[model samples]
Target: MKPAINPNKIVVFTGAGISVSSGLEAFRDSDLRSVGQHEQLASPHAWNRRRKEVIEYYNWRRECAGKAQPTPAHLAIARLEQKYEVVVITQNVDDLHERAGSRDVIHLHGELRKVRCCGQHALVSDIGISPQYLGDTCPDGHELRPHVVWFGEQIMHYSETGRHFKTAAKVLVIGTSLQVDPAAKLPKKGRYRAEKLIVNPHFDVADRPYSYRIIHKEADSIVPDIVAAWLEGQRWDYGLGRA
Candidate 1:
């Protein structure tokens, strides 16, 4: 079927829920315990006290991330790029969207497979397989840390994300409970004129009020169907003299 290429500019804001279908665990997943139980690791402060635990924690996540593959929802967005100018702004540190062939993804929460200097936000690079030990340093001898944006850190690409949203004609939000700040507030940052679409198993929008269509289902199950339906409608509309 001919893909729906919305002539309007398209953008997406995604969260960890999108990757849950591919076996990635969300921070609040019922099966997984809290960070405190997981050795109280994964923060800049924790890393400072016990760098080994922090490295080990992320190493575990890296292994899980390495094994996880992109779901159909990810591929649907990638396919959308074939017909429109697509820009993805994701809170997930996982690289699934990129792996699914989406070209322009802005990782707001940093990436799991990368490491950068703690002293300076140096260029993040791939350090495959193992944990980044204490001696792992950038060219400047500054110790490297997990490239993730922890609880208190400011998102690195905030300004760029704002700019992308400002120019977007349509914004689709998927798999997120809009409860967290900054990242949760991203979809609202876009121009008010942009058409908003929300896809989640349960829509959680208490803080902000925006008109949206809530598709109640798993992302992997619903997203491909949504994309295909939209595209097919567009094809039919164009084929008929109605568009």
Candidate 2:
């Protein structure tokens, strides 16, 4: 179903599936060993302890994410931002959403491009291009660590994300299974005006009790169509802002 075109405030919740079109791998879709290895080696405890393994793992991720670009689906959402107050809450660690010209995106998973100090949560911009070597260090004299959330650790800035959800007029779930915590609860946490919309080809969140519209399709195929339909309803012409 098409969403109400005149939405004042729109919050889009995206996931790794959106990045898969850009040649990135999802942890659940690929071999478990690679995902687990990367997670273990990139964790705070691992980086503080087994520094070499951590650097190598994150360096690989950095290289991969660096080579990837945003998909058409990402661009479509950015276009929506022009007409509606759009705020993206994404689980993907890549900067594709930003590259697509999205203004305000909250990464539930930390970015792969940035680095932080080992002891403190403080991050540094623009750190890795190649695989990070053993001797990487922050300007503050501490070892540089990956800016990613590892297993068994609390998600950074969750309270801020919850606050964003509380203010949303509509919640759009794109390319996510909604199996993960805190993020999984965001749809239900919003006000009654909020309408949930899920778009995914694989598993979906339709079994849940939230008021939602489910579209079983790939992001690249459905997003442009969805946005096209949304735009046609407005008084503005179709090509108002083409990127």
Candidate 3:
């Protein structure tokens, strides 16, 4: 049976910054030698031209994520489920949100712990923290590739995420700089009456059209308090300025 939608639903839009406190490095902040190399390694052309390197890179990522734990921000977001229905729309490929006990999560960048058949994208499987090697194949003998949304590849679940943003009673954006497209544009889709808030240490509202209470603080330091206030039926504004 389909469950009824909650009137107090909150759609959480997150990014790599949310996982930084969990011992994972944000993509933009990674110590990669150059942005060009980072982009090349994460692109489809590299998957075709340098398959071994692609596999090794993703394997390392999986290993790192596996060793890390969820942060206070992730846990606090999960606790919001105690009072309101929570739907997480995350740009991170890591499963920290799920690991932190969030029930409904929408991974926009795809998942690091999963692999899909190159020949048939629908044929996917979870590999947990295990490494995917060069010759890994699916049931149909096709090469298994990381199920991540690489550069130039379309992001997963766009329309569905938009629908959630439109209906949310509150929209919480955490740890994102709002630099990436389409996903960055989503906060503007929220219903005009919905309470919108962003908790990020480095977000800029130079030319945004919508209204949001911007809290210029690290998610780990601030999200728990925000969640506590919301759970107690209090607004999270508490004198923080708006954007």
Candidate 4:
């Protein structure tokens, strides 16, 4: 018997794992690969302590982000919106979800493609060129920095994300360990625990009672099937083909 999407408002919360297949790495795994490096480069302390290096570091990542492509998992997730009211809440800063055609996407972390002024966050702009220099500034003369949510900063969309999570009729968690705070807790703190589905190879917190549908696999390979089953009224033949 094929499983069906619980007929409810759907929110797919994605993480770094989903984007890994697209050639991006988690901060811990990147070239500046260290917990210390992440703290230094991706933290507000680091941003303030070494603004020039931080800008250089993010510029390098942005260049890589610009070249990265959306994976099959991303494409499958995008297709879900056709049959369900899907909103993608992704931890990734890349535009892969948008590129793959998902219209309603929220970046939990601030984006890698955008640069912002230190003084005015409203002064954000796309980074069309690599190596944003020290001189890059807003009209107000504040330095332009990567619009990412550093360690000391609140996530890019804090209240909006929680409100959506609280009201979501259903949530599909993909390729995340559920280790990050606040976001990790939202799965259980909703108006309705609208049938939680988790797809990931490994998660530290598998003991959570609310998560019932656990598909332990990489997303691109399995997500399409789930989405397909949901769209086709729960008719799926996993080994045979579409039923």
Give RMSD to native, each candidate. 5.5, 5.5, 3.3, 4.7
Error of 2 at 83 (Å): 0.6
Which portions of model 3 show Cα errors greater than 4 Å? 1-6, 26-28, 33-37, 238-243
TM-scores for the candidates: 0.85, 0.84, 0.92, 0.85
Tell me the lDDT of model 2 at 105: 90
- The global C-alpha lDDT for each of the candidates, from Candidate 1 onward, is 0.75, 0.72, 0.85, 0.74
Per-residue lDDT tens digits for candidate 1, residues 80-101, read: 8766788999988888999999
Q: Clashing residue pairs, candidate 3?
A: none
**Clashing residue pairs, backbone N/CA/C < 3 A, model 2:** none
Please provide, for model 2 over 195-214, each residue's C-alpha lDDT reduced to its tens digit, 9 standing for 90 to 100. Answer: 55677878544455366667
Query: Which ranking of candidates, highest lDDT first?
Result: 3, 1, 4, 2
**CA lDDT of 169 in candidate 1?**
67
Query: Candidate 2: misplaced stretches above 4 Å?
Result: 1-7, 26-28, 31-33, 128-131, 204-206, 233-243
| Strongest candidate by TM-score | 3
lDDT score, candidate 1: 0.75
lDDT of 1 at 175: 87
The sequence of per-residue lDDT tens digits that candidate 3 reaches over residues 50-123 is: 99988988888888799889999999999999999899999998999999999999999999999999884569
Q: Lowest summed-lDDT stretch of 10 residues in model 3?
A: 26-35
Against the hidden true structure, what lDDT does model 3 obtain? 0.85
How many angstroms is residue 221 displaced in model 4 relative to the true structure, after the best TM-score fit? 1.4
